[model samples]
Target: MTSDVRDTAVKDAARHEARLLWAGNRGLFALLAAARHTGPIARVPKLGWVVTDPVLARRVLNDHATFTMDGEGGVGHLWTQLFGPEMAQFFGGARHAEVRTRARDLFTEDGARSLVERSQGPWYAELARRLAGGETIDVADATRVLAGRLVSDLLGLPTDRDDDAFRAVFAAGERLAGLAMGTTASTELDPEVVERAREIVAEITSGVDAAYRAAGAGTILGRCREMDLGLPLARGLATLLAIAGTETGASGTSRTVALLHDTGQQHALLRDPGLMENAVREGLRVSTPAPVIGRHVARDAEVEGQRLRAGERILLLTYLATTGVGPFDIRREYVPETRQLWFGGGRHLCLGAAVARLQITRMLETLHSTGRPYRVVSRRAARRVLVPTYASLRIETHD
Candidate 1:
């Protein structure tokens, strides 16, 4: 790796990421920065339990009986307030397992490939053509639109709308996620904040009501309906899909592009395309899209030799947990402890992990198709948003 592009790229990526933490939610940033020096599982003064060890983080996620997703500090708590108690209970009881079991097939490797092609193939083809023709395109913008298009298609939302509509959908999802930024201190959304989130959810789920009724058996909403999950729950499910699928995918893909280029590893990927898989994995590992995972203590439990009482909350500094392995290297082997901890562990593991990986694969393939390394003409980081990603990363392949 060249010292110039590689070194500055790392600095730029860090700057953007730090800004995201500092501007979006200082409380979260403080906890994450402090967790590095603290023990594996320590009680944060106002933030409850803060767990930076990958081992303990997974322990909390796996202990559904003790560390649950309901109550005041988990993200589900915010959703429950906006949607209702029925939704909150769903996160705790048997229903979550049931839904994950039923919906499992949709995210298999083959299924993810098909879903990505159906939702985003043509766009990638277009991008490939443009780069081949010497056009510098905004890869970051393309990922956001692509992310929007994929979520809508998966949920059987209206697709007659153009890229702008999907971009709007992506932006709305970001705004919806942004409303929760203040939740670092507490997952409880203020009544007025809840109202704003409701409006955003309505915008996000506007298509879900009809899609829930008419979507085919292949779509997620249809599966919910078949399972007797009513419109409200269906809306909740769709909104979750929208948030989970969009922001993280967009963030991970674009940042990966910048990371490879900034680190001057594009040449390595170009030489041995077999490393494509490693490249994608390294990107997501370094980026760790969700960055942090939160849980609410359901009962008195012991973790890392410390006891946590019911009603307490825990924060998993996953970025630190995963990044501790090493810096970004396409040659790096998988870390045993942090096996895909970014997508999370246990029942709540991200359903779209395969799709997210495939999306980045396609984008990298498209760039590689030109048979030459692409250079970053310019890039800008997104600010005050839930995910730390480039607002614009303009690039062009060598002609």
Candidate 2:
């Protein structure tokens, strides 16, 4: 592609991404827009401290002693309300580290690839077959089901049903995450909201009790039982896995597809298959599914010369932090400062990071296997959801 074409492609990708955010949540889009003008760290009126610089954002994530997830303004605060105070242990207490250590192998590269192949390989095969037959497939919808299938297999849930059954799994998780739509300025939830969330939690974990009892050691619930974490915490952890693994993974997958098409980078990947890894990284970086990360101040600390006191909150504008660098390019090298900041940093870094990457890599490879670049037929942005993504992104490969 010519330099002018590359520039135009870059702008087109940004436009589509902006629309997804706008359609998903206006408040989030506004915050991200404002962050562009703010300094590296600035305090907003009701939103607490906002950090847009990649370096500062990673610093807050790594500084667990000074910033916590269990207190006000953090995601854990929202979970504790729905799951009880014991849930706090999984956020900052020793239990957090213990759980990660115990479940470490399940999330490793080899383990992740095995899980992906076992749960989703067949679906990919079907998708590839359909594309090759000149069928237009909705990549976004496929991702939801794929995410549901992967999480179900990982949790040892019954995956013996149809695609709609797995779609229901994804839907339940989406409804649960939707409850947090009102939690941007405050992590605290209304009593009624908490009640509704618990109801949804029950729906998401309807099969967990049986799974925990009989699931093999390779599954997460099985590990929970081995750790003797009890039924309540097990339920909480299960719901967490459902939400954490599905929504972000689904969003990243679909958006990566759209990003490659919108930026005209799919042809580049088709030419140089070795750029597949870089393409995946650039996709996740450009379309950061979890655009904003919130943390509660644990104690007085200085970040970028700003003194933050306990009881306050900080919002890391990860979307702006990662995208501020540049547009998505398949050939772009790894960034030093933003080293996987999209997956987050420090001890709480996403345990399913490898799983997420492998999923995207598989998706790109499937599109490439057609031996012809695919064209997006149409796409609609998901609305009023925790993660901004496409509701339907239809595509058909050229003959």
Candidate 3:
């Protein structure tokens, strides 16, 4: 496609994306829209500090001592309310480092590829076969099931059940994450909300106790037992896995599929299968599933000439930071300043980054398996949720 055509296509894709944001969370859509012109950093009323620059966001994320996850404005604070202060150790304590260290091998690139294939390869094959037969598939719903399956396999949750069981797994995680929708301004949750969140957490961890007891050494719960971390924290960690791995992975997968179709890049990718990796990178870069990252100002610090006092909160607008570079282009090179701000930075960088990338790549491969571009039949944006995503995106191979 010509430059003009590609630009128009990109804008069209962006408009649909904007609608998803608006439908899902109007407040976030407004913040991102306004941040475009707010320069690098700005202080917003009631929302604390907002960082739009990728470099600045990375700086704040990397400054663990100055910006923390366990205080009033951080994600850890939200978790502590539901799981209790003991759960705070998973955020900032030495236990955090130890857990990541122990779980490191499980998230490595090779490990991620193995895990995806072992847990989800058959599903992808079946999806590709269905598409080839010209059957419309709900990409959005399928992703949720696929994500749930991966999480269950990873945690040694029972896999003898059907897709509905896994969908229930994903729904429980989504409801739990939705509870945090009101936490943008403050990380503290009301007693009622905390109670509700705990109920959802219990649903997510219903199988954890059994898994922890009998899971093989290869599973995360079994590893927790080997570490003697006890059942409560193990349940907390299991719930964390459900949230961290489910919504974001499903959102990224479906959104990427929509982007490739909407932007008319499917043809380019079909012509050159070697661009598969580029397509995946560009998809995650553009979708930016975990858009806003919250950090507590642990100590006074200066960033880009602005002084951030201790106890204040800062919201890193990662979605804006990542997308500001340009529209999605499979040929786009790696960005240095932004790095992987979408996954975060420093010691807290997303442990599942590799798995997320591979999952998206695998989805794209499955769609292209028949050597034909797919067409979007219809889509509906998920509303009243923390993450902006499709509730259902129907598609089939183009005739």
* Each model's Cα RMSD: 1.8, 0.8, 1.0
Against the unseen true structure, what C-alpha lDDT does each candidate score?
Answer: 0.86, 0.91, 0.90
Per-residue C-alpha lDDT of model 1 across residues 281-333, encoded as one tens digit per residue: 99998888888888988789888689889899998989898888877889887
Candidate 3 worst ten-residue window by lDDT? 81-90
For candidate 2, the lDDT comes to 0.91
Cα deviation in Å at residue 191, candidate 1?
A: 0.4
Tens digit of lDDT per residue, candidate 3, span 1-399? Answer: 788988899999999889889998898898899889988999999999999989989988888999999998999898888778788877888888888889889999999999899899999999999988889999999999999999999999998789999999999998999989888898888999999998998889998989999998778898899988889889989998999899999999999999999999989899998888888888888889899999999989888889999999999999999999998888888889878787888898999999999999999999888888899999999998888899999998874
lDDT string, candidate 2, 1-399, tens digits: 799988998888889999999999998998888889999999999889999999989889988989899899888998888888999877889999999999999989999999999999999999999988889999999999999999999989998889999889999899889889888899989989888988989999999999999999999999999999999999999999999999999999999999999988898889888999998899899888889999999899888788888999999989999998888988889999888888988898999999999999998888777899999999899999889989999999995
- Top candidate when judged by lDDT against the true structure: 2
Kindly report which residue pairs in candidate 1 clash with one another: none
Rank list by TM-score: 2, 3, 1
Once fitted onto the true fold, the runs of candidate 2 whose alpha carbons sit more than 4 angstroms away are none
Worst 10 residues of 1 by lDDT: 16-25
RMSD of 1: 1.8
C-alpha positional error of residue 77 in candidate 2 after TM-score superposition, expressed in Å: 0.6
Q: Please give each candidate's TM-score.
A: 0.96, 0.99, 0.98
Clashes of each: 0, 0, 0
Q: After superposition, how far is residue 243 of candidate 2 from its true place, in Å?
A: 0.8
